[model samples]
Target: MSATICAFILTFSTLCGSRVVSGVLSAPTNVSLTSYNMNLVLRWGPPEGATQDLVYTTEYKTSVTNYNVGCVDIITLECDFTSLSVSMHPPIIEYGTYTGRVRAQLGSASSAWVESEQIILDRDTIIGSPRVSLLSNGAAIYVSIVDPVFVISTLRNTYAFATYSITYWNGSQKEKARHINNTQQNHVILKDLEPWTEYCVQVQINVDRNPNPGQLSETVCESTTSVEEAPWVPLMVTIFFVALAVTLVAVTVVYRKSISHFLCPKDALPQHFKENLLKPPNSTIYLDSHPPVEKWHEVQIIADTRTVEEEGPSGGSKDCLQRTA
Candidate 1:
């Protein structure tokens, strides 16, 4: 989105042109306020030539009161009051309505103070402008919030809060702008748009607490989707399904054996082994026979003896004895 901010400058003049006389100088003219980096600046144009040295002072007020501040006394054509100090009951540098004035000064002589109308600064007013997007491939426009809300409860800014307002119009002549409001939901999609037609849209923060609305986003304009490609949708859809079916068939043809194993497998072992596995009688296999017993026999032995006797030496022979076995 493209955007431009106006730098407002206000000036006052006591003399018509560069006419020179030995007296107080003329006030500035064509004062305009411009938006810059979320701040306001004042700029103006002055007469062509100058002879005497001049100084400047400025004042601002949220309400009617004495507001005095130092404006750059240099020969510059503009002043930035956003950072300027002031002597006032309540300062205008906040988020509220303000009115300001400026005057030219010499050593002793001074020009009349020229005052401005009500100048409102909610420098914190609108968040960065909302963003516009084209959708339906260009059939519709989308509007939504792009930044957080800028709220200054210090000033009790009581306007439409928590809502977004969208305005749209056709590019053709005599078309009245249409609007829609949404609560909290910061986005909206416009449908049933005329194909190939141009449209404009803008969005703003809606404040319900007061009549004043939040600032508007930058305006966006775009052409709707074209109708020339309407017939291609169904043709593309048919091609998609046909391609999908062909891919599935090719995969199945290449991996048929793996698919069969996964879906239907056969038994790998005999059925009898499974049946007799837990039967105790059939659980063991013996390989050896029984052993024979041994018998024993007993025997006895007999002995016989015979005896003989002999006499003394002086006597005749005595009896002799002998033993036999």
Candidate 2:
């Protein structure tokens, strides 16, 4: 009984010692890969009941390549592998399928490596929304597009066959939106539009290999310029004519008598006098006709010398008096 008890104690001690010697930090959990706009990130959850300060190291691998060390001694739970570079290893390729692994470390102790789900760089990545701007021309709209920026490369560089899909509509009528697809130009002009009309535009990027298109951009609105004449032109002309007619009516009402006097003078004879003058006389005076044919008769001249001498100058009066005598 004594030997058996000692053996049992030894066995218990050995088991406990082995457990304490082999203990290590807990590994990260729920390791996963997420991508956006051609940017790749590896993320994981912290170990349960973890109280000690812990650091993490990540590794990534492709099907045809060996595992390569990624972020080392990182305290954060996430790693950005989009532009991460490893020693003696090439960068992540667009067509490559990748897997990631992360483990927790505390000094010399380390947990088991946890692997993440596989992800296709080109297929699984989401494309972000593009930016749109608009300008107005005469009866036309100029659409300017800016492609979505990416962590690895530009939208056009990554997707070589990419195209811009444009949609525009009159601001007043959204149901009549028009679409222009597969346009390669970033600056596009929409013509044959109504003059001085407000238009709203939206832009999206489309890739041939991608089944889903990019997110739609924010709607931008602008107004098209007038083609021939401004809308206010006709309104101003109508107003001018109305004002002119009003002025003319006011003048005619205020100065009617003066205008009538100017057109017909007041110096003309009376209506009765005009009628009498126009009428022929009934008979002429017979005595006046005979007196015009009478002969002239000589009359004797008598000089008044006394009155002339009193009224005239002295010498001339005397000469006149002597001649008269």
Candidate 3:
């Protein structure tokens, strides 16, 4: 009977040790926070030996005194928390520090708490809508902070401090134009810009000097002025004037030559001589005379005959005979 009891005890001890070994192997490990923005995310490796399904439970603690202010159950290796209201309620706290841990469970067995590194949960003050306007010689951008309603009695000034910067893209590259403290006036002049070129500008603001700054505001795009001139019109006017002057000179020369040809002739002579030279002369001749007497006849006879011809017929016959000879 003693030998049988020893065998049964040995068998029971072996079974219990095997079960404990399996449970230890099944616990998750290497649990840590992967990334965080406003919320927290936890990631861990899968459990080891046990085949049965396992679940993970996460808990957050704002203070070391209270370790279980919030809890969540997750079946997968990853877990996400959209909202963390742990510090807001009953146990009032300051602006920054918070801690959290995660655990794995299977059936009746549970693993140890895998605590995370301490993280800060500070309140972020957002810069309000920025004012943009065009100035006389440049552009101006104004940034303001949204006033928080809850006032802290310890601090004298309630206004949150903010820093701002203005940047402009000059087609090929970007340049930092100005830096403003506490959201003051930011003005930048667009000098020496190429005509008809495009420019892009951006304004950035950071509150509480957070290293990872907020989103950049929308870009403002504008084009420069044109540079072409009205030279063609002037050129056309000059050409027209030159052509008009040349035409007037040609007309004047032609008129002068025509007037000189008409008023003054190359050959100079008297008007009467010119007219007689131009007229045609007559060819016929006219004469009134008596017939010439013969040489032998005396002068008295010739004269008597001439007188008789004038008075009678005998004288006319004699004058006819003398004219025949």
Candidate 4:
């Protein structure tokens, strides 16, 4: 009886311990991949209740050229290997077959390894074309690009660094293509264009310096402001300002005297003067009375001798009144 009880307790204890061990570890699931713009990304979902405490490792292999194999430790749910270095000569003897796998680890516990399906990479490897918009930025066309807004998860994991190509034709026989190299720059300015000429622009992708270009976006057409139209606004503005200034100067010159007088006024007289006068007496005492002897000296009245002698013809005496003092 004791042996049976011991066996049952031992089995129950073993079952409880197994449950506890299983609770601490589980394999990852919902593993997926995406490749966009030639950039390869791998992703997976942890088993239920797994938090950021989980760390994952990814392994990839190719079936072509050298059957490349490499692994990287990832702390996030997603891992980007856009810069992953490996033999990329596509087709593992099976048309560019490539595969990847992932597993989780925590302390000394680990989840089982999960593998992915074979994938093929080629010209038709489902690369999403970028969406492009255009703006007429004075003498140049502003080209703005964006990665495909809507893309499936699987293909989004796979992509490579891309170069944007701005090809334009100005109604000429020769079409020119300019390559912009800073990776994933959303904007590029197309300069050195002819005004008043119709221009067509098309943008495309060159993945990983591939010789064959990806699909081209739709063509956009626009025309620049004409040379005659360019200077009209500025010329009119200049003439208006010049006329205003001239009018102001002429008005000031015409009213210069008035302006100066208003600024500083003059008085009526320069200086003031006072006068002194003597009044005449009512009766003339000096005219009627003889001169006072002490204040006056009288001179005898004399006549000229030659005149007195020669005055016999007329029989009139020549008299002279003279005062000698």
lDDT of 4 at 73: 51
lDDT of 1 by residue, 152-202 (tens): 232224333447777788877426878787655656777667888887787
Candidate No. with top lDDT: 2
TM-score of each model, in listed order? 0.43, 0.58, 0.42, 0.36
For candidate 4, write residues 79-179 as lDDT tens digits. 65445543642322212456777888776777777776655544324455667776664567667776654222322233446567777777563346444
Per-model CA lDDT versus the true structure: 0.57, 0.82, 0.52, 0.60
Clashes of each: 36, 0, 0, 18
Error (Å) of candidate 1 at residue 114 is 3.0
What RMSD does each model have against the real structure? Answer: 25.6, 26.9, 30.5, 22.7
lDDT string for model 3 (1-325, tens) is 9999888876755665323433442346677653232444566775544344667787656645566534455687766543445355333233445566777776667777777776553343233334343212123222222222222211113224645565555545555343333443444454555566556666665556345454565666665556433434656999999999998888778787776767885667889998998776653332324554557754553433345435435545655666877
The residue ranges of model 4 lying beyond 4 angstroms of the native Cα positions read 1-24, 64-71, 85-95, 123-325
Best-matching candidate per TM-score: 2
- Two-way lDDT contest, 1 vs 2, winner: 2
Worst 10 residues of 4 by lDDT: 316-325
Candidates by lDDT, descending order: 2, 4, 1, 3
Residue-by-residue lDDT tens digits, candidate 2, 1-325: 9999888876755654322234776678889987888877899998764544788999888888878888899999999886675455558767778999999887787888999999888778878888898867679887889988887767777789999889999998999999999999998989899988899999988887667778899999999887644545666999999999999999999999988899986878899999999886676654345555568999999976566435445546665666877
Candidate 2: where are CA atoms >4 Å away? 1-22, 86-88, 172-176, 228-325
Which window of 10 residues has the lowest lDDT sum in candidate 3?
Answer: 147-156
TM-score order of candidates, top first: 2, 1, 3, 4
TM-score of 2: 0.58
